[model samples]
Target: MKILHVDTSITGPASVSRKLSAEIVEAALRRHPDAELTVRDLAAQQIDHLSSAHLAAAQGTAPENAQVREDIAAGRSALEEFLAADLIILGAPMYNFGIPSQLKAWIDRLAVPGATFRYTESGPEGLVGNKKLIIASSRGGFYGPGSPAEALDHQESYLRAIFGFFGITDVTVVRAEGVAISEQARATAIDSARGEIAAIAS
Candidate 1:
């Protein structure tokens, strides 16, 4: 088994999402001892945001320039990594009620038409097959199912939609909400998320 752990947190050690994701990975490893792990730290590596050049490349209309070819290759490589993983773990923090730009960039690279998705007579069919996905989300405020801020939860919903577009529906979300509300709430949320991780691991 292969697992790809993608972390988009910029907060490093102080990031709740990062800590929770690590725990999730550890749990997964315990369940599948032979799993091979690949870690992609988007913030640390500074993935480039999709640009006109990338779009051009996706359209197969790259210029004669070498840089365009390089960018296209990079995008293809990123997509390959996503497809190659048996399990994917995303550590995403809510920023402005949405996913971080780093995760967005990674999504752009992977959500290519005819690559990750295809338009069938029924609808858009996802090219990627069944793979387990675990998302660890950290939010500054409560955005649960019925909370007032629930409508603002584009972070998890958008991710599910995008991944589902590619036929990935077996997704598990472990959220640590209200991390910035109060010290007690923050600790409690983290601990609760950790417990959830332990259960999932076991």
Candidate 2:
């Protein structure tokens, strides 16, 4: 299997999301011992945000300036990676109740017209499907289904919507929330998330 591992946590080794994401990948590796793994650390290799220059280059409307060429090439590479992966493991830590801008930039690149999705008589249809998404999410506060802060949660919700738009229905989220609440809470959350990962079908 081709497993694409994407890490977006900027906190390095100290990041809880990074730890959990690594564990999740390890669990998957145990199942497919020889799976081909590709790693993209967005925090380390920062992807340029989508811009007008990028659009102009993509549409071939104007001359390809060096920056525009670079952005367009990167966008194509990101899309290629997304399309080739049979399984995606993403490190999605909540930043101010939403996803980090860097991660959002990557997602923007993936949403290419007539590539990942297309408009048809049946409405917007996804061209990409039959892929599995596993997200390791870390949140400072509790924002699960009936939690007090649920309304403020946008990170996971947005991810679900985006992947679902691409016709990816098999998504598993191993979330470690309330990490900043207390030492006990942090331990419990991490442990619980690890247990869930262990229970995942490989």
Candidate 3:
């Protein structure tokens, strides 16, 4: 199996999502001992945000500058990686009630027409339905079902929606919420998430 592990956390070692994602990857490795792993750190190696130049380039126009050329190549590379992976493990931390900008930029690269999805007479259809997606989600406050701030949760919800649009129905989330409530809350959340992660390989 080929596993694409993506980390979008900017907090480095202090990122709960990152730690949980690594554990999830380890569990996946244990399950598929010979699985090949590819890691993409968006924060460290950022993908340029989509632009008019990128759209023009996609339409067979040459990039206006060297930077645009490089950005286009990076976007293509990102899309290829997504297409090549059998499974994707994403470490996504909530920032201001939404996902980080870096993660959004990466998603933009993957949402290519006719590649990951296409228009059908019945409407839109996703082409990449065979791969599995597992998300390691970390939030500063409680945003799960029935939480007062649940409506404010655009992080996991958006991820689910986008991947669903890509035709990936086998989506799993291991979430560590309320981490910023207190140190004890953070520890408890992480522990609970780890417990959930234990079931991944079973």
Highest TM-score: give the candidate number: 3
Flag regions of model 2 displaced more than 4 Å.
62-64
Candidate 2 per-residue lDDT over residues 150-170, each given as its tens digit: 999899999999998988889
Mark the 10 consecutive residues where model 1 has the least summed lDDT. Answer: 54-63
Q: For model 3, how does the per-residue alpha-carbon lDDT over 127-181 read when each residue is reduced to its tens digit?
A: 9999999999999999998999999999999999999999999999999999999
Q: Model 3 shows how many backbone clashes?
A: 0
Candidates 1 and 2 compared by lDDT, better number? 2
lDDT of each: 0.89, 0.90, 0.96
What are the root-mean-square deviations of the candidates from the true structure over C-alphas? 1.5, 1.2, 0.7
**Candidate 2, which ten residues in sequence have the lowest lDDT sum?**
55-64
Report lDDT (Cα) of residue 26, candidate 3.
Answer: 96
Deviating ranges (above 4 Å) for candidate 1? 63-69
Q: All candidates' TM-scores?
A: 0.94, 0.96, 0.98
How well is each residue in 156-200 modelled by candidate 1, as lDDT tens digits? 999999999889989999999999999999999999998888778
Query: In candidate 1, residue 154 scores what lDDT?
Result: 92
